[model samples]
Target: MYLLELYQNNYSKDLVLFETLEEGREFVAQIPGYTLETEDGFDVEYVNPKYLPDYMEIVFNGNIVPLSRFSFNSEENVDIIWKEISNLSVKNDKVIEGYSKIDAYVVNNDEVKAYVEAREANYRKAKDFIERCGYEADRSFFGSEDGEAILYRKCGAEDWHFLCHLDPLFVEIEDVEEYVKEALEEAF
Candidate 1:
């Protein structure tokens, strides 16, 4: 297999796959502003599927998302969801800021809310565990910045003991199908 990238005005426009170099050349002949270049040792079958990106950006219900603000199921009924998302047009010029509120299609506002709530509850539970075990936990200890890996030591003990990386329980949305206007609204 062959992978051909099409760029317009120095920006990536599209990517097309071909079975042979001849077929790829044929496509290049029909289109303008594209150059065909074959890469040496670029065997399609040699590529590892696991290294490929797991997610895709798609538009649905006038919103481009599966908002990165929250994490959910990777698959999420992709075939059906893609059909819906593909129907909508994507705005190439729109800029997405880091975790900022943007137009989004909410699969389930309730699930998103529940996931956040559950994560918070899990943090509290983790703290409780340390206290019950007579251990003092500090997130800033041992150069740990995020609370995900908590540093704990026996109460009044000099040396810091082990790092507690708790696995928090979270609600996973099964599919991307519904649109909840209030979900994304409340998240922001």
Candidate 2:
């Protein structure tokens, strides 16, 4: 199920799960007030990860880290709770960091590998993609034909300034659109 987040004024952030954007939009339409975010603008959208990234950002205790240059045990599936150990060490400019709170179980190895590859592939041409999106990267990530992404805005200047997923559970990429369509009844 895809998560639908709601930012109600003077209240706690709320999240609802849905299988598709249309479904989520429909649900939102019923709410007295709700916000539904969608990703738009891109030259080409990758629906799957085609490359591996040097590092993966996991949110822990409301923070993203285990940043680059850390001992990212490429040793295969080392489960480490990131937030529990982010500031435990520091060695000059090359300080050490650990995984904050990425649950290894939620992460599908195949999906992670694919996402990493795709993100890295886009890295070289990130600027081009930015230009293609009209430089309006209000949201850090966009939902493309490939999958969900992490969009790092050079400067935050748009509505909806970040990707809402990537929670502690950290599930793999999903074809949310397709997932929703399958639930509909046949017209015939």
Candidate 3:
């Protein structure tokens, strides 16, 4: 049994149980962008952050130039098209020369850069929390049945805290308190 914790955002958390680690990895791959936990030794298609605008071409005096070569400085000889209150035109040297705007077509598409960044940050926080708490999947027998458990404990603590049962069947015991005490005594 495997326990998978997914952090979709900073405020939301989802826990999933899988019989095998492979199943968990397969589920994580279905998500679009790369996550912090998914990057660790997982065989998934990691997506690189792609910038928007298929291509930015600026037309100046019948000459088209890429965005890289276009200058927005005040000293440049250019009249940037602006659609302000009515139509406005600003000439070089910070002067508003005319009251006419440029006719242009705009595409309102969603940007994924910020979303990807927030997702990755949330995943990183989840990973850090797991590490700080020393939580991990471990095989242990509850009562007489063998199963996997997600356990955690305070740093330098001798007792193991049971987080959740990864197995589908919820194995119960008469006294969970005695079990931890017995386990600790045996370890010492």
Candidate 4:
């Protein structure tokens, strides 16, 4: 499993770091109001440790409300609660920056028809765009068949990553258009 560290502040930040499953459990237990109310229910909250001994801060209703009084019915509840909190803490760290789509195209004919025209067309267009934008054109084999071609380009000195596959005969033209748009969005 992958763990992401969200906030690392001075006072309680370093002590609250969780990079592994074990660390996550330890961190959850350290929280002042961490507990489970029922056998099946797993509810836990992170509270300032400094305020402990005198008062407990319960996290409920999306607010860190003070717990005037609270009690646990069973030890199993405490275990379940910590387990749930550990899982949530790990999930909160994963951040998705963006996503990219790859467009694929297949040729209509079974016979190998050199994709000279398509390759030249894409290369020309990509080259011109790159040159105009003051960027270098990177070349690479995306995929090739007897008569099909696939190539890609990135702006500037960036990597020339393949964004899609183009099959003139099998793939619909409309899908190819959408794929191109999505690829550009992902690239940027």
Candidate with top lDDT is 4
lDDT by residue (75-159, candidate 4, tens digit) is 1222221211234444455433222222234333322234435545655564565455454554444543422344455443445
Whole-model Cα lDDT of every candidate shown, in order:
0.37, 0.34, 0.37, 0.40
| Stretches of model 4 off by over 4 angstroms after superposition | 1-115, 142-158, 165-182
Off by over 4 Å in 2: 8-12, 33-111, 114-188
Compose the digit string of candidate 1's lDDT tens values, residues 53-156.
Answer: 44444343343432221222333211100011111244544332112211121223324455456545654555566666576766543233322444567689
Which has the higher lDDT value, candidate number 3 or candidate number 4? 4
Sort by lDDT, best first.
4, 1, 3, 2
Better of 1 and 3 by TM-score: 1
lDDT of 2 by residue, 47-146 (tens): 1112225555534335443333223233322221111122324444532332221221233433555545544444324434443544433223334433
Error of 2 at 14 (Å): 3.6
**What lDDT, from 0 to 1, does candidate 2 have?**
0.34
The whole-model C-alpha lDDT of candidate 1 against the native structure comes to 0.37
Q: Per-prediction RMSD in angstroms?
A: 18.4, 24.2, 24.0, 17.1
Candidate 1 error regions (>4 Å): 1-111, 140-147, 166-188
Compare candidates 1 and 4 on lDDT and give the better one: 4
Give every collision pair in model 1.
none
